[model samples]
Structures are given as C-alpha cells and as structure tokens.
Target: MVHLSHKFSTIPINFIPKQFSKHLPQQIPSQTTPPFIPFSQRQNQRSLLESQLISALNCCTSLTQIQQIHARILRKGFEQCCYVLTKLIRILTKMEIPMDSYAKLVFNQVENPNPFLCTALIRGYCLQGHVKESVFVYSEMRKKNVLPISFTFSALFKACGVVNDVDLGRQIHGQTILIGGFGFGFDLFVKNSLIEMYVKLGFLGCGRKVFDELPGRDLISWTELIVGYVKAGDMESAGELFSELPKKDMVAWTAMVTGYAQNAKPREALEFFERMLNEGVETDKVTLVGVISACAQLGAAKYVNWIRDTVENLGFSPTRCVVVGSALIHMYSKCGSVEDAYKAFKVMEEKNVFSYSSMIAGFAMHGYAYAALELFHEMVKIGIKPNKVTFIGVLTACSHSRMVEQGRQIFESMEEKFGISPGVDHYSCMVDLLGRAGCLEEALNLAETMPLEPNGGVWGALLGACRTYSNPDIAQIAANHLFELEPNAIGNYILLSNIYASAGQWNDVLMVRKMMRERGLRKNPGCSWLETKKGVIQEFFSGDMSHPRYGEMKQVLEDLLNRLKAIGYQPNMNSIAYDVSDEEERRILITHSEKLALAFGLLDINADFPIRIMKNIRMCEDCHSFLCAVSQITRRVIIVRDNLRFHHFHDGKCSCGNFW
Candidate 1:
C-alpha cells in the first residue's frame, strides 16, 4: 500500500467538499477481502482522533510537541480540517512562532479554505508584526470569494495600531465603510480597535471623528479617546469626554486617575480616585498605582500611612505587587523617609529591575549614595539587567555625592561593561557630576564634544554647574543653546541672569532681563508647600503674605531671621539677580518662598517631628546656608525638596555634603 502520510496530504478533509476533487488523490486503495469496520464505527473513530489531536494541540507547550501533533494529524487524514487548522494556527501564534515558518505552509496546503481558516492565518501574520503579509492574506481571501469575519478587521486594525501605519489603517478603515456587508458586520470590537489605532498614531482628531460616528460607543471607545486627549496634553478635552461618558468602568476611572497623575496634577488625581471610590467602581492594582504615584509626587508624609494602609486593605501587598512596592519606595523616599523606602524594598518577595531601580533612585534622590551603590552592586550580583533607568539612578547617586571618579568609571563602563550605551540623560548626569565637583571646563568640554546631540537636559546641567561655580562665560554659552532649544523656559533665563549677577555683571544681567521682556517671558513666581501637623496644606509664594496666618508667619520669619543673623549668618547678597543695593538684596533674599515655608513649618510642625518643605524652584545659595544654620540652632532635622534634589539639614550640615 502507498504510504499513509502521502495519502493523507491529498485527501479531501472537512473543509474541502467532495466536488472540489482537484486536491484529492487520483486513486484510492480498495480492500475487498479485508474484514472492515462498520461505516458508523469508522466515522466515530475519525471524530475521536480529531478530538484527541485538538486536545493535544491545546496542551502543547513547545514547538517540537506541536510538530509531533501536526504529524499525527497527517497520519489520521485530517490535515485539511478547517476547525482543527484554525486552532493550530492560533496556538502557533500564541507560542510566538513565526507565521512564515509554519502557519503559512499549513494554510497553502488547504483546499477550499473557509473564512475562519483564512482569518486565522491573517491574524497569525498580524500577531507576528507582518502587517503587509496580513493585508496580502486579506486580499487573497477576498479573491477567493470568502467573506471576512468581524475579527479579521479587528486584527488588521490592531496590527495597524501596533506598527503605527495610519495610512494603511485609513485604507482598512475606508474599506470597513465601503464594503457593504463587512461594514454592517463591523461591531463594537472593530470600532474600538479603529479608535485605539487613530489615538495611538497621534491622530486624536481622527479618533474623535470615529468616536462621534460610531452608532453606539462602549467604555473602551470612550476611554481610548480620553487617554488620547491626555497623551496629547489636552486634559480639558479629556475631561469633557470623561464627563460625557455615561457608564464608567474601573478601566475608564483608572485612565482619568492615571492621566492626572502623569500630567503632574496630583490633587486632581486624588480627587478622581475619591470619586471613583464613591461611585462604587472596583479598584485594581492599576488604579492603586495611579493613586500611589500621585502621593509620591506630593511627597507629603500624611498620605504615606493612608496609602500604605489602603493598599493592604485592598489585598495588594507592596511585598507581593512589585509595582506597588516600587511606587511605595519612591513615595517614602520623596516623603523624606529613605529608611521606610528601604524597608519596602527589603520585604518585596519578588524583585525585578523596576524594584531595584526605584530603590536605588530613592537612595540617590535622598543623597544616600553609599546605600544606592550598595543596592546597585547587589542587583548586579543577583543577575538583574541594569537598564537605562538603573544607570541613571547610579549616576545620580554619584553626582549628588560628588563621587566624581566613581561616576567617571561607571560612565565609561556603561557601554563596555553593562552593554547600556549612555543616552543624553546619562551625559546630563555626567555634566552635573563634573559641574558639581567644580570641573566647569571639563563639563563644558564634555557637553560640547559628546557624540549624541545634546538635549535641553544636557544644556540645563551645564547651566546649573555654571550657577554653582559662578562661571558666567560658560553659563552664557549654555544659555544661548538653552534659549534656542527652550525659548519659553523662564528658568533657563533666570539661571543665566543669576550666574551673571553673582559675578557682578550687571550689564549682562540687564541684557538677559531685556531678552525675557522681548520674548514676553515672565518669571515663574517661586512657591513652597508645607503640610502642617493638622494635615492641612499651606502654600507660600515669594513676597506674598496671603496666608490666613500671614501675620503670625511674618513675625515668625522676623524672629528666625534675627536668630539666624545673631549666629553670624549674613545673607548672600549675590543671591538676588536684580541690579539693586546690597541692603535691598538682603531684604529680597529673606522673602524667598522657601524661607516663608520654613517659618510656617517651624510655627506649626510639632517639636519631635522633622519639618518638611517642598519648593517649586531650586533654593538660592543664601537660603541653603540659612537652612543649615537654622537646623543647627533649632536642633531639628529639616528636609527640603527643591526642583532638583532633596536637602537634609541636620546639625549645620546637609546630606549632599554641600556639593549640590
């Protein structure tokens, strides 16, 4: 008898009708004398074999196992069964096997392929990022007079979204409208997939147009457009859609919360989270992460215990959820408790790259350089790959601590040892490290000669270093680049003017002021936030005594100034960037937002607890010195987080060792 395998390849299976005899063998072996089973028994045995083959395909965990099952299908003469073949194609896609290597071959062997079978192959190609191949497959299906299913369009649109092929997406989108039956068959799944595609491709207007045209919109459709608005930085549009959404689910609620958190609107995030809770929407790990991230940005100690408790109450342990643990580590660190951040890091049963990076970043941000480096070494020992973010944390630790040599070695070893090429961010860290170490010339050299095109961060780092060392010449060069790169960034102009003023270059300072005026740029008023013992947040702006306790705060500031002056703390007159009298400069320096926050903190914060202040701008030299003296005089630890890094003052010294 002819080999059974060869016979199976030519047999007409379930998908192929008997009239489609071109794929069938020309002759069949007849068994006249053999004792044969009944026709019902033979059919039953074939069905049983088909069921067993499908079950085996489902249980297959490896490519080799799948190949064995495919061989078994051929032996059973069921290779062309559309149902079984579709399942095989889906399994191959799930296993991430390349469609070209196996699925395509299986599809080509089938005769009179069904719509579902063709769509499965198209979906397989789409899953493997072969969009062109999927489109080709669609064309072939159309040529074969096979009507595409709903999932076919969904898969194609999703592929378009993945590759950001908006042009092809538009083509497919147009087909959905032009093709009569297919357009009517375009259900919620296809519509939502189209919305997601347009949104992800940065075509929010198109996405909205699709949303408006949909006969009925679901939660996914609304959420996709809302998230698109948020990503485009148009929160107002996002809010309008969000308000218009009738039935909200947890995913929709989480999108709003996450949008606010990502846009740096922490208060709005918390408010949305509260609203989500009040509406009785269920909370998941994603929702909690959004809330936790907002709390981290706030850096308020009062929210720390509450958020931690909420996470535990929801049965999402920081120790169990690495994301929660990472967010907690960041929260505690920003809240001025590096110890608590470490505790969270220690209890994490499963530590990934994120956990290690967050903990190290927390240590670095808190100026715990030794701790950051130790953790980094431990991460390497445990074989977790150090990504760009991890290296950023390591370099930040070195920069803040003035570990110039150590930082340099690591910077050099980035591409060579760790296989992580230094990005613009890493170069920014180097500029900061060298600049902080008083290596102005070297930092400037590195900034000018680096392989990558420097971004705002690189120029900003150089400008910051210039401010630290009072190098007006280098600051001007950095400022010129910054002015072109970030014309509207008032901080860059302010920093440049400050550097010039520090060197008593009044003419240059006036020129900077003129440029600011010509560009219609106004100085960003410095603001500081302080959380009181009663958990009420108070804000202080430079030279603004608008607080309800302004009178008491003024008196407190005056007393502290007197006490600070008595201890030989003279105001650094150069801190004022304006061309003014020395005495007037002293008057202006004392009214800075940080000083105002410090006074209010001393007044309201309890004696046992450390005072925490958050500032919108970097503290001036005079304020830094003033806080050091105040910390020594009051015998209290003061933690101040500025625009850049944290300053922990205790007994007349800062945790940064005065390098920052």
Candidate 2:
C-alpha cells in the first residue's frame, strides 16, 4: 500500500539531487513531463517493484503465467534490476524451463550483474543438468570481476556432483581458495559443498579429511561425512558419527534406517526404528519405507501387520502409497502369503515399475508362473514399460515352471520390444530357464557365448540345473568357470561335488573336496529357520541338537523318518556330500537342517495353518521326497523357501513338479 510512485507525487521536480539526475530516464518533450526521480527514490521504487514481482512469481503455477509477469517486468523498465532478474531466473529453473530459452534472454538483458544475480543464473543451468553451461557462466562472472558469492561456489560444486566430475570440482575448489581465502565466511559453505561432492563421488577418505580439517562444523557437515560412510557400507563408522551428533534430525535418522536395511541388517534397522520412536522423532514416508523394507526382509507376518497399521496411523495407506504398497507386496510374498501380496497390488491406486515388478516377482517366487505372466501383460497393456528387474521376474517365473518357449520369447523381446538390452542378470535367468528345463547343453552354450561376460550367477544357475538333472560333465564346465569367477564361493564347489556324487562318480567328488581343502574353504553348515506362532524365529543347524526340546524333536524326526521309510522312501546317499558308509549316510540324511525344521513345524504349528520353513541352501533329494510323503500322510500344506525358489508340497506333489 505504501508504494514509491504515490510518495514521489508529493516531492517537487526541482527537489531531485543533481548528482542523481543522470541515473533516471530522460524527460520526453510532447508529454506532460513527469518529475525527475532522485537516485535514492529510484532505488526505493525498484525495491518495491521487485517485492511485487516476487509476490506475483510465487503465485505463478505455469510457464505462461510467469511469461506474462516477465512482460510486466520489461514494461516497468526494471529489466536491469539484479534482485528482480535473479528471482526470475530461479523460477524458470523450478518450472523446468530450459535455461537456453527465456532465462538466458532475461539474464543477457542485465548489463552488469551482481554476485547474487550471477550465482542464480549459474544455479539455473546446474538445475537443468547443464554443467558445462554453468561453468561457462562462472568463467564469465570471473571475467567481469564480479565477486563470487558463497552460493556461486555452492552451485558449481553441486554441478560437479551432478556430472560426477571430480577434476572440475577440484578446479572450482582451487578457485575458492584463491579468491575467498581459507576459513572466510564464504569459504566454509564452499568447503561443506566440496565435502559433499567428494562423498557423493565415492571418495570417503577425501570427505573425511575435509571434515577433519574444518575449523568449525555444522550438522550438515557431519551428515555429509556420515552419509559418505553409509554409502561405502561402513556402517560402523556411520554409527559412531551418528552417536556423536548432538541433535539428530529426521534426515539423519532416515539415513541410518535405510542404510541398515540396504546392508542386509534388517534386525538392526528395526531396532533403530524403535529407538527413533522412543526419542519422539517424527516419522515421514521415507523413514516408513525403510522400516517397511526391513520388515519385508525379516519375512515376519507380525512385523508386516505392525508396519501396515503404523503406516495407516501415520496417514499413509498402501492403496494410495505406491512405495508402501510395493514394499508390503514384497513382505507378504516373502512371508509365504502371496495371496496377501496380490491383494495389496490390486488395491494400489497407482502402480509404478517397482509395484508391478514386486508383484511379478512375488508370483514368480511362489511358483505362480501364469499369474506373473498375466501381470506382465497387464503392465504392458497399461503402458507401463518393463524394466530390467521386471524382465528378471518374468524370466524367473518361466524358469521355475519350465516354460521354455515362453521364456525364450520374453528374453528375445527384451531388446526388440521393450528397448531395454538384456543385462547379465537377464542372461543368467535365461540360463536358469533352459537349464532347469533339462536343456543343459543349450544353457551351457548360451552362458558361454553371451555378449556380456557371465558373472557368478550365470554359472551358478547352470551348476544348479546340473544338480537337478544329474549332469556331471556340464557341471564341471560350469564349476571351472565359477572357480575362476568366484574362487572363494564355497557353494559352487559344494554344488559341483553334489553333482558328481549324484552321477555316482566318487573320484570326481573327491577331487572337488580336495580342491576345497587346498583353497582353505569349508562348506557352510546347512541352516533353516521357522517363525513360531508366537513370532519368535527359531534357527536350526544341521546335526546341532542344542535346542531345549531336542529330545522331543529327535523323537518327532525319527518317527517321521520311520514312517517315510515304511511308505517306500529310501535314503538318497548322494544327498550326503561326504563319501561315507550306508549307515552314516542314513544318519546324516535324518539330521539335515530342513528335516529338523519340518519336524519342529509338525510338532508346534497349528494343523490348520500351513507350515512355513526357510532354508539357507538347496533342499536335498531325500528331504524333498520325505517332505512330499509327509505332506500326503499328515494332510498338511508345507511351504519351504530355499535359497533359489519356493517349494509348495501338498498331497504328495510339489509345485515345482520334482524338477527343482
């Protein structure tokens, strides 16, 4: 309301300072000549105009509206005002308007820009991902002798982070020291941003040194180094810094939660979430996502339900939250509730690549190949393109079900139809699909000749299939490559030995065992886990009878084994990786981890509820047969999730059809 234009009317034309006359516009002859505005009054008028322009820009939601305001700026003869022009530049950047278009034109109109204006333009280019152009602007600012602002160096550092250009970042770093001097007001900001750039570029030691050398540090400085350590998977260092943070915020808490989840320490992630809650830290969607993911990894239904209710209490619903829904789908499926996973997927209001892929992978993991294929088609029909992970799910479904033709078609269409070239993981899936279908030679050929060099997964897939189909010769080829690719992977050696034993080739099995001894590698003990009705996870190790109820568990297993033998099931001597006498092999087979888990589940789990068991390694032949018989005799549905896939046994049949 107190506009400069109204106040100027009360002042006389002759009252203008003589020294200020030249800065104002010249009077015209024909028009009733307006009074000459003094330089101080003009400055006030320009500030008022800029304030009004900022208010107007804030309300502009679209490019067209902002453009109209830009025309007003030009009409008011305020085009050269750096205060107004800098705001204009940033608004355009926020609107995602290209820097080359109206922004550059507006910036070019300012004859001499101050540091603020120059930095704003630099940030505009940086925000648009035009790092080269932003550097060019920095150079021009230097040529014009404009003192760079703290934000100018911040923008340049940010640009370097975007392009991952450490060399350019160092050049800017040198310039900061040369111009701003060490420990200057602007220098701290520049140093902080430099630390961030180095951390983001995967130089943790450099970031640490920068932090250590800083005379004073802020939360942001500490957080930058902490995140750097977290990204490097050095959670120990991250935790130490986090413990030292005086006042932690939501961002820092979320970082720890997500970091623990990403590094496969789900229990630690859950513990952090609880601690954060006790500290009265407000949780956001990001924090909730990390917690949800940890629950998914735990594969516990109680944890899943708690997180779901907690999310709803926090005003987030899986139906409306795509990220939450995707995480819930993954959790439910891993918990042996694929039906719940599908329900979540169906209720989601929005489905992104992650949502569809999670659902597809859930179906594939549960051996519902047709459902996975149907979801893929639906995703395509809805114009949601399949990403690399999506194709992995599709191919995995086909592999589990032995749908060779469908698998081949999907693999071929990856490049031609989806425009995503097959990655190494895709090739691995193809090998798995062909190998699991008893096409050992074809799978081996594809793995050996793929464009990308086969990683451990590719060879591992072939070797696993060799175990299933009893192909010792091809297993050797795969094992040799795996030995070179992953020399320390004891599973590969164990798989090769098992394959040889399956073929009744004891000498080759001895060779594999001898090689393992030579390399100082020992087989990992077979382990299994089953969640109790009370939500306690019970872990079992092969031949470890240390449980409180070990006597009862042994009796249960012996009774079941005797029944299995009476029903014509025999001990698979090859299942024992060691060359031992027949009696020892039978004893070892009965004491396998999964069988122990199965016996415990039968004794403790409710008859109505299906028994869910998780194994760290592949199920052996004798255990698989024994479980099938157990399922028929007890009239129970048994769900066993091994390292590779799920096996659903019901009424003397397995979902994998005795193929896996």
* RMSD of candidates 1 onward, in order: 5.7, 7.5
True-vs-predicted CA distance for residue 28, candidate 1, Å: 14
Identify the leading candidate in terms of TM-score: 1
TM-score of 1: 0.86
Overall lDDT per candidate, in order of appearance: 0.85, 0.85
Model 2 bad stretches (over 4 Å): 1-37, 41-147, 156-192, 349-353, 382-387, 411-421, 439-453, 470-477, 504-508, 566-589, 617-626
Task: In model 1, state the lDDT of residue 605.
Answer: 86
lDDT of 1 by residue, 508-553 (tens): 8889888877888866788889898988778889978677887887
Residue 390 miss distance in model 1 (angstroms): 2.3
